[model samples]
Target: MMKEPTIENFLEFEKKYKCNSIKVEGMPIWSLYRYEIHNEIKKQTVGRTAEGSEPPINKKDLLTMALNALKPFNYRNVDVLFVCDGRRSKNADTGVYENIYLDEISKKFNSVILEQPENRKHSTPNGMDNVYFTDRVAFKTNLAVKLSTKFNTPKRKRYEAGVRAAFTDIFKAIKEEFGPDITDKMVDEMVDRMYYYEITKKYCGKILDKAQPKLIVELCYYLINNFAMSELGKERGIPTAEYAHGFAFPTHTPMQFNPEERISVLPDYHLTYSKSQEDEVHFPDNVKLVPVGFPFFERERDRYKAKYPREEKTIVFISALAEGEQISKMAAEVSEALGDEYRVIYKLHPKEFGYYKERFPWLANSKVEVIDNSENHMFRYLAESGTIVCTRTAALQEGIGFGCRVILLNFGDTALNLKTLIEKENIPLVDTAEEITDLIKNNKAAFVNPNGMYEPNAIENLTRFISEIMMN
Candidate 1:
């Protein structure tokens, strides 16, 4: 049997091969390819992988992007440039997409540009001033690069040579480590990304030149566009920050980088949701981890608490697509053991909603009510439930803030990811439904104080940090 693919094994390979040292045209190409290589290795080794589908560019989204681009906004010399994905949730009351991470801080800045790639059905305009789109810019840049490759220009020659050098180094490392069986597939992935990186560089460079923003803030820094923007910001002496969107575990490869490498593909600052996250992953030495608190959780917790009064007999189980089977089975068993005394809500992750019934057939027979809507945020469920159950999810961390009793399912990465909370001994960990039943029936689990993890006045702290960075 072949050895199981693990992040530790891949990390070791990266260190031994000195993958981070590989570069093309002064940009760290290996960092951009690391995630791709990791996924490919897992797919070949395990015969399966979880790769999400990238929605194709439709006529409506393109039209929305065109309209957003035409809106008049001074893109020059802005205080900040905020970029986020278009897959946002529409605010029921306001009827506009909400950028949970940057909205509050965006209001603080006198001059800022809120840019998005393209509009999705779930995530449309936030009706805010100074909002624009960059899909057309990326489209044109990528198309131009594809059309201009036939000419034997000096710039094209330099690009080709640099790419060849980087590819040779990476292929040599992979061949040395894993042999030639998987080398071609991995190389093909890297080649595809090299072209994408060019698009990202030109797209980001154009936006930066036009805006000349004092600071750049982005969500989900691992995106190639955001990574390119960070490098561009460093080149221009402008600072870039990323809002940490999810929990970082030891298994997360994209967050880890060689501390010794001088060129960083990541943002200068990583704005985290809480102070406790610092202990989760070891990042590059220069990328500062700042705990700015999570205004979305804080705000939603209060709003949901007011809207839905807490029920002492309600239990909510947070589901993750990666661990869907194990988590759903546990939730079903617990529901059976509880015997209708408590109301159980199994909240499915957005990705799980489409095939959850077919994937987890037992859910249909289970007594628990499953919530599977994008608009119904998880924080709302956490606020009303007396107990929150989960294996692996950032929602477990947020559940701590809602003052709900958290029961962790000790399967796979759940215990590993939430190691700190487990060590604190305030939350209980159980492998079987009986253990969960006993804890909930007896009300034996203790709740941790939220302030220990999340800092207060999140928006104020974030805006203050932005101001300080702009001044320097």
Candidate 2:
């Protein structure tokens, strides 16, 4: 029998093939491409296609460049610089998209935010200065790269040709290892990503030259611009960090780095939600894990705890992008089986926001109250609910912190991803409505160590960590 393409098998293949050794322009290219390769592996494992949100193309590149030049903003000698993607949410009162990860942290210093544009209802609100958009940065970088290509020196020309040849050879080895799953087109995409990083690094290097920030931080460091910032910040002797955006599950590809791998680019520090998460990942020697806790979660938990009254019978189903269909059906079944006695809330993942109505038509007619807007705070729902249901969401940890017992869905990779919770907390995994209904009625909850998941004094810890790094 053929071996399944599980993470363990993939890791073995990666070690045997020495994928980390693959380089482009002195970069260990495997770190840049591993996420893409893992997505394919996951698709095959789950029998589902990967979900993606295509970045908007800057059509008016020249116009944007001109406007930026006309109203240039200064970024010289800043205390901290935060690079964030378009994952933002509207404040319940303000209705403006806020950077949930770094908004609080950014207030502690003379910080500058470089945010990507997203197709959202509102942009970052006024009053706070030093907020800059990155579409123009991307536009300027692309033009500079094109010009550099047009007028390359003799050595530069040779280097370009060599890089192309190197990718061709690397693709052959990748094809052999991954079988027909790896493709020539995918290899080409990776090559484009290679050039994108190098050019973005050069462009951001100029900004760093002016800013000379004491510390640099990003939400998710794997993205192209953020990864470039990490590499550049390290080269310039500036501290770089990535905030813990979600739980570092064992099967999570981006978090699963081999210690022996010669991965070139990484943030100097990983600011995690709690110290307990330190064991969840195997990071490179250069990277340090700091338990800074979660300021946003803490703030929300406290605010909503005061604002809302807990409904003991309310069940909130936290959805994951990949397992939306299955979760929706299960949540509906549980709601119907329980009838008017229970209040069920189904929260859709951000990726599923656009097409969920079409994708899950039953949700419209189901007894569950669907929370789809980014404005609706998840912690608010948690504050009001007594029990949480999920398959593979990081929110399960947060749910436990809110004093809610969990009912994990039995299907999919829930057992694999949440193995620790199942063992330690004794969370129940149920497939049928009868199991869910019985669990709710019995009300026999397991003890969960909330302090282990989220430490006390998050904002203080984060500020102190930043201060220490800056002083050092």
Candidate 3:
């Protein structure tokens, strides 16, 4: 495992470079460090944090950071400015704040910058405000090409070539708009600088620098961060451990907030459009719970029904099909133990389906069906199923809400808290496939009438929380 870098090292780099001004464009949703920069350091805001907290700094911070990093360079005097889209702000208020902030900051700088690779602008809500926001030094584009090359197949080569062509076109357009002197060599060098500064340092081992998707995302961050830092007149150097910010959840890891770390957390269900109450847990004072909204409730419900036609068999829902192989094998054992009486359905992670499909072809053909469609409502499937089984998936809560026989599979000591939660809530726990079979056979009626364990308001609570966060 890679050792987590120390904050002291990161801060040392920040101080050494004299990176006084920082411009951040992404949402501070999962990333706590962005909040530290904006709220604690009072840097300018490119936009609101994920929880809708306004940053202290405005667009000028980005310009200042960029200028400081690339001192003596005349990018400050450039007539055009390019601003790429980062995380989406909550609402029009946030959008307007971003626009006005950028406009005010641009006036303080010299360039009339344009943002884009053209295609990325499609998702921005306010297109008019993003006329010139493109980063020629895209790490993603390069990474895609590198991945394609590494794979080294006719199909992969074609994909890489397509990416390169698209980037080249965008680069050409930007150069034509600005001037021919923004040579290809200069662009390549800048992109390289960004790669080292933003990506290679953090994701050195987990992702190949030249890999397609990894490269692309890293490049995007590099371009955006590099531009902002350059405007602030800071020098690009090997980012120290202190410069390494807090790890963002979702983007960094699928797990919940570390109880040991002093970090902010939005309500678990609040990040989605569900209106669920924040569950009380021992959290640090520095952390705040922001709400999230779920816009796809109805659509998700409809999709779930459409994809997994409900059947008579008891449904056992499993998340992280890749990581929960033992649970799956156990499920299979339970199915055998029960004979033809039960139905087992495995909900495969959408991204990992291809791998799972390859590994478990039996699941595809067996009475046990593997559902891979994410657009479908997972909760709905759980509702219709007879029982739900998982070691430590969030789906257990959803299953209980649907009045299904929720079974907790104790994989290891890591899931002790989950087991405790289930036991305290009076949720059922099964130790083995034989026990699962016995429970199904003996307590079929009780499983269907689960009492005092369901909380259907999770969606509503989540939605309300998100709205509140955004509005606040």
Candidate 4:
């Protein structure tokens, strides 16, 4: 087994793979896992992390876990195909990797099996490659079903029903939204689903073709959307681990599904961010919950320099998906309510800044100032601002580290209630702009630093765990 992992150690490790018997002949020992490792290694730098322009994760620590997983396998031949899990596969692997480490890491890797980001475009584009590229895996057996064999009239009878059922589900959703009548809404929904269905169908044969897998590692991404990768991994009886890219069982997501379904779809090992996070989820006996603390939050807490005792007039609202417009509107309303003394600095998520600008053209005219998100770190906003309001976002979790007095906004209704899971002492769920205004106006909210949610040696714990699993 390896000790401290570095590119040099990895290169040295590859030297043992000179024998022909141990050489993985057909597929490059499935490079997807290595690609994830490469990305995690890249994550361990200063001012850089997982998602765009926010807090950083200790991804280099995660790369350590990845490297450690290889300790037990003293293989002689190292030809591997590091596949990308498309874009949606981005998530928490083992809790080992975080932003502080990931901050300075670069995009390139110095290994033969590892792949780069552009390699994904070549490997899994929406065009013909979405199915399967033979360079990665090309095999067929009576037990395995191929997409090409079932592409036509009677040959594809089993698949046609599934396609029809999907369309039916889309139409049902349309009916739910647009009332009991058929209209253009249903047509649009159907057309969109049909287009995707046809496109995705091409990938099935390519994905399902028989191929030997030494081990299957799902980047632990959107399993429902990208089930092919996970499903193929399971069907092949390969040892698979799902890296919890983010909250594996968030209040808003897989946690809402049936335990049986989640368990069935989940990888053999379900990695988590922390013990506090893992304790909340009741994963099945088959799924081991490996809790590695949040690397970004931990590192920040250690190095955090407070910027408090400043001007109290500015209010920063951390934005989330689908709630940007609502929060922005409320910021404007609150600014108008509180008059010129108080201003709402709406920190828009980087991805939706353009959309919000186009949606609210009067943004410049109002007291609400949309923060130039690039200019400052989110923790700065939490420290300097008066009150923080947000929808379901990682920012809220980070808020706990900064002693942020947060209010969870009830944006649009969904089955997921973020507060039920992410319970902290300071946060109170708010449903209206008036409630938020009252909190700010009355000075009812107080920011207090919480104790001990982060573990100091998370990287070590995660590395030990992944190594033990792979070693067995």
Candidate 5:
């Protein structure tokens, strides 16, 4: 019933744009975005996988595909570029292939450029003269701030008053607890620790008895832009500029902003590109979105049934517990508490699997299985699961779609608001393991509310938008 574009349509797009060069930019988290576009474009235009391989690709394979895609456009003056956050800090293979891909793409175009952090000291092939390095902090600050204001939610007067009160309390606590002997170094350390603590709690599931002095410092940095600007200037050893020049792509919104120019990417996508650093400015207008795809060997139902055919346990799907170890541990605790009564499976985000592997090595040998394969789709897991437990993941919607029980855990202030939506829409919400166990014990069926939140056809909309941009 859905109208999907064919491979031919994508090939036509490649020809039309003469897409000799494309700059791929964004964090590792955007791998999903990259994979979709790379797969679609390669299949349609090249009539093969871009990496000269089949599905389930790695960094090298993907780079090969990117190089292959640009091979046909060799006659054009334009060059394709691929950019990423400092890959050296992340993956060695990724950083190396990024350079390799840039070199290969350069052979096809007048210039192929790969941008990396100026501070990073990774050696690459010298023949790849197209490789360009730039100040990572400068580029990031410029780009992020430019696009940040656009997504900034205007604070209500009441919220502002609350913030002021919270700040006053924080300052009072800091002065009283740390004493007047607190040096600048002490203050900085305190702030850093608090920031780490709060973030760990929010994303990773660590709770604090009270707000730390460090949190107050971090909050001050966030609220007082001048302070951050001054601190960054000191750290970079550069004169503070009046306005930030770069652009950023915030997660909540795909929009880009330029703080220095006070311009937004909504009106002009051209600004998304960096002018000085060819490697740094890669922003592709086009994108593709693909579902987790059909049944695979890693589907939770298949694996569980195959392993334990006679046992009947309620299945709870914990989607992508990869961001923070604390959060993963909390999910693990919930699972442990539930025990044999329920089977809890933690699905790691494909992009964050590496992080999970490093942070939770014990998971490899634990009773809890971390599903890492791409073939094991999210929807299939949800379809087979009895309940889905998550902290603001998109998987909640999919679980709901499959009529699986939904539990929003440790939402804090957002809890009541979410509860209202669930009540109005007739969806269920559980915040604790005890509550979840009770729901399962009672044999509750999750109600589907027709008026529940709507997820747009982001891929189709994005593809069509990119088509229009290219046409212009």
Candidate 6:
């Protein structure tokens, strides 16, 4: 009998041969890597000494092979109805985008409709299209979640193996294409992203059936779900586009440079933040990059005149993953350094505040008033803040928009791409707590956009871009 193929065996193979995948001429990085792994296993095990035996295939391989096998959905008719999902961020969803931008966009076209998995939805508007991938994905995910509570069973473990393998494929694929410039943390992150991305594709067939939208427009197209949604639209011959919600830094994923033109899954049109961001991603020829301003910036608060300048000293610290201690220590340091003149406000990411709280027990003892907003009101802190500090977060960009003197704590595994943004934006990147104090005391940073970082006509550009794609 052939040796049973396990994730352990595959991982051992990966660690040994992880850096050895050669690029195929026309294929994308992942397709070539998958091909190599599958063939290498077969070449070693299935021939020569043994008379007749086939190499054992793993679950992840099976899924990847099956990805392009299915014929796309064909809905013969068409409506100008635009379909998209709600913002995964609760704050962004309920805040302004849904009520303001989405409503305005919806009104411009024939109608805009929601596409959400039926079982997973809650309090979504009743009139929207209900997609049906929840039955399949929910069963697998719920079981994994339940089994994850204490320990996973052998059966659960096997499926978990598949999950890890999927993530591994994604990580290897990025490295194979982009070379060794990627950080280990980013590779790991993109893997989990690929796993979630695969689950989201399970919705495409359901979405296509319910609403054969002429064009699919999504918020935050960079996210796995929206990206997956747009890819599915392309598969079925529908035009797709995305509105830029934030900066697309850390450009290490396949989304930045899809290897094969045949399987390029990026959205057809990208409504970007500005010209600076447009030059950042370096996407392929087929993907249209449109420069637009940040629409939400018009609503950003510029009103507060300093009435009592001394008392208005508030330092806001945006938290980073596994850096709870750093945040707490920084808060304490800022308070001590400035005495009663400065107050530190730490804003926690969902990871820090959610299930991973145990990893950050120092939050309880910290002097800073930690906040996690449901209203996307991090802007309020930036508006009122005298100085803002972060590891690597979009809030840093928000701080820029508000004219707060920003500082980046570039310690440990803070993303290299963030360093790129800091250099480009001219924000101060500090290493030690002492450096932060000096920068804060000096109040030395540019208050104006040097690169014309924000284009003024965002909504106009986005609307016009969509109109062009639809017309084409």
Using lDDT as the measure, which candidate wins? 2
Where in model 5 is the C-alpha error above 4 Å?
1-261, 264-314, 319-330, 333-341, 349-366, 372-375, 412-420, 426-428, 449-463
lDDT of 2: 0.75
lDDT of candidate 6 over 303-405, digit per residue (tens):
3223223223688888765356666576667656766556777777644544324655555565666775434456666766777788656566667666676
Candidate 1 least-lDDT 10 residues: 113-122
Q: How many pairs in model 5 have backbone atoms within 3 A of each other, for residues 3 or more apart or on separate chains, i.e. clashes?
A: 21
Candidate order by lDDT, decreasing, is 2, 1, 6, 4, 3, 5
Candidate 2 TM-score versus the reference: 0.88
Write one digit per residue (lDDT tens) for candidate 3, span 123-211. 24533432333232333434434554466656444433443443454335423432332234433333333333344223322211122
Pairwise TM-score winner, candidates 3 and 4: 4
Indicate the TM-score of model 5. Answer: 0.38
TM-score of 3: 0.44
Identify the candidate with maximal TM-score: 2
Against the true structure, candidate 3 has what lDDT? 0.39
> What are the runs in model 1 whose C-alpha is more than 4 Å off?
1-9, 24-27, 43-51, 55-74, 111-122, 137-181, 444-446
Candidates sorted by TM-score, descending order?
Answer: 2, 1, 6, 4, 3, 5
Query: What tens digits encode model 2's per-residue C-alpha lDDT throughout 1-472?
Result: 3445566767777787677777767766667878787776556554643464643434464465446545455778899999877667677777766777888889889989877645422255633576776665555655645555567655345545555566555546544555444555555456556667777777688778888899999888887778889878767888899988977777777777767765557888888887777777767766888888888887787777778778999999988777788889888888998899999999998778888898988888899999987776788889899898887788888888888877888866788877777887788877876788888889854547666677678999999999998899
Off by over 4 Å in 2: 45-50, 55-71, 119-122, 138-179, 444-447
Model 4, runs deviating above 4 Å: 1-162, 165-220, 223-226, 235-238, 245-251, 262-265, 278-285, 301-313, 338-343, 371-377, 413-426, 446-449
Name the regions of candidate 6 deviating beyond 4 angstroms: 1-104, 113-202, 220-224, 250-255, 258-261, 302-312, 322-325, 355-357, 412-426, 445-451
Model 1 scores what on Cα lDDT? 0.73
Q: Per-residue CA lDDT of candidate 1, range 1-472, in tens?
A: 3345577667677777777778776667778877877767666655434444446555665565566556444478788888766556567667777777776678788555445463233255676766665565555544445444545456655656676666766666554554445655655445556667777787678777878889989888877778788888888998999988876776677776656645566888998877767776567788889988878777777888888888978999888756777778888988998988888889987777767888888889989889876676677788789988887677867777788887888876667666766887657888888898899999975577655657778878888899999999
Query: In candidate 2, where is summed lDDT lowest over 10 consecutive residues?
Result: 118-127
